[model samples]
Target: MMQRCFSLLFGMLAWSAAIALEAPAESHPGARAFAAELARDPLAIEQGLSEAAILATLDQARYQQTIIDAISRPAESKAWKDYRPIFLTDKRINDGVAFYRAHADLLQRLEKEFGVPASIIVTIIGVETSYGRITGKYRVLDALTTLAFYYPARAPFFQGELKQLFLLHGTRFPYATTELMGSYAGAMGWGQFMPSSIAKFARDEDSDGKIDLWNSISDICASVANYFTAHGWQTGGPVAVRANVDKNARVITPGSLEPVYPLTQLEEWGYHLGSNPGGAKPDGQTPVTLLQLEGAEGTEFWIVFQNFYVISRYNRSPLYSMAVLQLSEAITRELSKPAQ
Candidate 1:
């Protein structure tokens, strides 16, 4: 059965590669405007493809309403209560445990080397693509090109990503832009790294001289750890803790995820530690932030520490960080139980 599955996978990959190579090299009329723009870059020329060819490939990408709609209503926009169940599911938690055990050695080594917890790394992969089961169905070229030229709000950012994608295609990864698949926003692989993130932090963990996040578990896990370490993740630190706040007291929550207040200041403002399993309370001088999530049950409060803020750096979403933390906790708890 495993042999048959492997053969089937190989066949699909070969088919995809063939399709990518057959893509037209001529520029589409719509893409001519961007062709000169992309050609101005020396790096684009270094890719060995003419500016027209690059833009022609991009021209095949159409403006997708699904992309616009997906970006407009991200999971982070939902309240904690609503968002929590989406990622912290029974299936995700169970599959996370299985994945952790399967990659125990790699996870342990990554933690020792990068100072990121194994559970946290596992949770990230689980949330991003359910351990590689659902990386995405959209072509990365289509996603980035559509967003770069059509999405008015984040066009500049997507345009930059589009450039980086071309650069990545020229260098580290040798594949057609249309051949690779990823999220609507061009985040790829199990870790859902943007093109810039892949260029900056992705690693070839197995030392095979190729970084394949789609199929290489070692690269995927290590790349995630590298990203956390780069973003200043503190080892052995609390991610967040439930906090009790006075109902009548006016609490000041920072508009951003960055930690702005010290623990002493938060305590003085009527925030007290509520439930912490790790049992390590930070010192008075430790930086913290109050995260309040509105739910069906009214409101929930959490005291987010440095690690929580670091997690937010990945996606800039408090809900996302919370999901990763809670999912990690759930996976750890499940792993501790005896086999059924």
Candidate 2:
């Protein structure tokens, strides 16, 4: 009886071992990719494409090569820091002057039509691609797909961008080859448009029925103006100003796109604007926000109005907005000078 019990126990142990061996592995590459795609859009993506095609696209995509290449280092990176000095140099400033001089009429026209400053527009072009010199080398589609499929932290957002990209391609291209190239985040053109923004805001200024952001300067300029206009750019208002902050002032909230405070409130805070700050709004005390930025020496203070806030909408970062503002100011100052 004892020997029979031992045999039964031994048989049960073997069966349990077999069951454990038969279980599926935890890491499923196919499932993970599908999950990433679905998380971006469960309904929008798996609609028409076959599972095989989807899987093949993910598999054939060069995810490994693209992810490592596309991810830009933070401003702490040597490239960004090194790149900053080049932009802030005298030669670039002189070049900015020359650029403005060459395109004075067009810049003025856009400013008049869009209520955005010509200097601001020129600066954006200068900083983005050195006035249309180096846009980017990576194909936008490849970048988006690689990041979406492989970069786990922000995969879903990139996947949504990929979806928008595909949709835009379908809407824009029926017969021609659909290919896009831009930054790692899939921002195309001198303006760096994400896929959704391209669909929503990209314009056909050339009247060619196609918006070629890659090569058309006219389209890029017009699109930038349109974007700013859509975001509430006041026709003729101050963008930013050097300010004297009172020692006693307690708090200063950043301004939003809307005019939040009256001009009276700003003056009361011991802030005053420089003469010819673009076009000042009526002196009815429109509320303004005081912003302080890091400078080489002491902190730089500026009292920004509604218009200044509008520029920030394009890029939420204060540093980016300030860069745009400073570069624009530099361009205008250089242009205003008599050629030496």
Candidate 3:
């Protein structure tokens, strides 16, 4: 999976080169090529997805100017100090507790079955879509198609998702390709799964033979839990905690969220858990991430473990992962309170 990054980068470079060389002589250059590729794909042939339908769907794809603008300025672009307050507010935390309480049995059952905490699942829903309150307004077909064919920086990635969007009809998934709605990035449901994610992780929790991310609460909860479980969510393990930096030690920036180094190794690089480190502590040999963030007070450093990295896999932003962790912990605390 590490090679996926390199492959994506190489694809971006290729797209950029092509765009620089010539003007697009046709509309949806990316979609046209993508359709051609899909027509030849063996899976597409086997799935009974008609090439004609694929072309028709691509024809219906409208390039949304707003989606382009939105992707340019994601919340993850904001500083951690500014970003934390958006999802970490009292209202969000309180709502998460209420959501958890309303579906305690199902969420807890999923937690027990999947080894992912119910609070974390609830927090993901809260973070991704405000518990299904704002899944998105743009049609998923338009968003994916627009980004697939129009956005050159990551055209290949979006195009692949667009392919998966068409293939969703062939799978056990319930939504029609054109009728689907999601984020500007084409992610759907309470968890905002992209087409590929839906294909791989979406679950029919109620056992109704269809996976519906938008309407079924059980499906939403189970699908989110399945995603976390598949991504290696560690049950009852450390997510992250504050660490004090040795003033004289050299700065250490991790290459990626994949926990590549041990806590003992980071200690030599001048980072270690402060005296007040919270959560269940991992052993010194645990592979960890040395995270640096700009906080309200000053620079913040944290030691994050595999579970923390798993959170990052949900949303690649370190800030997003931290917010999910904080919100999950906050919900757990709120639940522990004695009812007034």
lDDT of 2 at 139: 66
Question: Per-residue lDDT tens digits of candidate 3, residues 103-210?
Answer: 999988999999999999999999999988999998998888777777889888988898888778844685678898889999998899999998899999998888
| TM-score on alpha carbons, each prediction | 0.87, 0.74, 0.89
Which one is best on TM-score? 3
Considering TM-score, where higher is better, how would the candidates rank from best to worst?
Answer: 3, 1, 2
lDDT of 2 by residue, 1-340 (tens): 9999999999999998765433221122533455355435644454454444444444434433544554745342333334356567676677777777787877788788887887777787777677777777776656776676557788778878866765564444322213566766667788777877877877787778778776776778877888888887777667777876678865676544345767677777676664557564457566567776666655667777777787777766556666777777777777777777
Model 2 CA lDDT for position 247: 80
CA displacement after TM-score superposition, residue 79 of candidate 1 (Å) = 1.8
Largest lDDT belongs to which candidate?
3
Candidate models: Cα lDDT each:
0.85, 0.66, 0.85
What is the C-alpha lDDT profile of model 1 across 182-246, one tens digit per residue?
99999999999999999999998998887899888999999999999999898898889888887
lDDT of 2 at 203: 77
Give the lowest summed-lDDT range of ten residues in model 3. 20-29
Which residue pairs in candidate 3 collide?
A: none
Model 2 has an lDDT value of 0.66
Could you report the Cα RMSD, in angstroms, for every candidate shown?
Answer: 9.4, 10.1, 10.3
Q: lDDT of candidate 1 vs native? A: 0.85
**Candidate 1, 338: how far from true, in Å?**
2.8
